[model samples]
Target: MVPFSLTAAHGSIHASTKQVGCQPLASKGLNHTEQQAGEFRSSRRLVLLLGIASASSLQRPASATPYKEAENIQYGLSNGNIRPCPGGYNPNCVSTASLNDLYSPVWRSSLTSIATSAQVLDSAVMQSSDKAQIVIKRSMPNAEYLEYEVPGLFGRDFMEFLIKADKGAGGAGEENSEGAIVLYRSIAGNVKYLYPFQTAISDFGAQRKRLEAIRQTLGWRKLGCDLKECFE
Candidate 1:
């Protein structure tokens, strides 16, 4: 290759015309002032790099809400969910049933069919080389329930989705609309924590984010589980 430029033995930069770079300060010794100036510029670049790295490290992280101790977590259709979506004794779970914004925002089904909803869920959970696996699925008269083993950074969560096909007229929140709603609840099934060293490694608000990921997969908007699905 042709030389873009060459340095003179006397002392000068060897670089492309577009930019000036490289110092032969060591190869050909320079005056004390010139050497100090070069050192100062190098030090400035180093400091700038370190400052950027420090800022990134200090940025606020996603707050994780942890359930330190194991609590009474209930599941299944027969196990008394008299009032579904209620906050349980444990903090590791997030539900469409809770009033807290941290847990209330529901994924809109957007007139998607119950069967299609199931398929979407199946697809979402099945995409990442089997990252999310359905462990159990059952269907009743108007609803379908599916349980999934969703893996997280620290552990896996046992997530359940109760997808209900509402007629919207006969007490489905409206007198003449029709749509579907999915009630989600997840518990830290096997959260790994190193005791006192890492006592809390439960739900770091991952439940909603997981659902949100599925929402994007299904192309659904955010809504309250109580609100009727109106978009076609």
Candidate 2:
């Protein structure tokens, strides 16, 4: 039996690697006619070359680096449980098909921890409102993004309230004086920063430490912390 590599699309049956990269060929060989025989062989060679190229492209490189968030990666099924990445105050939590829950209760808890930690760190070092902005990014099969623009967005303000209401502590500090309006606003705009922003968030040393600890506890592949504080 051939091992099947599956790739999925929106609400569609998983496509096998063959279907993605190979074409079916007639079993019959070149016929009796000499003139037709040459043409048949040429056609077969062309088809074979195309198929090879396609297959090569589809093959996952053995040396390819692993996706950083494989543990947090959620598989979306057309008919399976989906606890989607929750949004702010009005979270749209659903366990229906066409969705897969990426953010779980535990994941939300982690977000809360990071948020509190972020706020604490900010208080210690923050000197400008510009450095206080909190950014959030969500990834899925397609590009579906939701962002919240809050003033004086320090710490985990974006993740905590969105995932677990008011679990994150916040102070008006200097942001409140400038605004008479409720600071939170669902900025209805295209999410262009999903990938890079996620990278930025992941680069934070504290997050990397938490991820390393979680991975180690799970007995998955472990990572080393170069920073003295993180290792301790």
On lDDT, the leading prediction is 1
The C-alpha local distance difference test score for the whole of candidate 2 amounts to 0.29
Q: Which pairs, if any, clash in model 1?
A: none
The window of 10 residues in a row where model 1 has the poorest summed lDDT is: 1-10
| Model 2 lDDT tens row, 33-109 | 74356556555655565565567557575542222332232323223123233222112222111123322222212
Using TM-score as the measure, which candidate wins?
A: 1
At residue 194, what lDDT does model 1 achieve?
A: 51
Report the poorest 10 consecutive residues by lDDT, candidate 2. Answer: 179-188
lDDT of 1 at 90: 47
Per-residue lDDT of model 1, residues 54-117, tens digit only: 5655658655334433433456655423123324334556776666643645455656467667
What clash count does candidate 2 reach?
A: 3
User: How many clashing residue pairs appear in each of the predictions shown?
Assistant: 0, 3
Q: How accurate is candidate 1 locally (lDDT)?
A: 0.58
Q: For model 1, what is the error of residue 223's alpha carbon versus the real structure, in angstroms, after optimal superposition?
A: 2.7
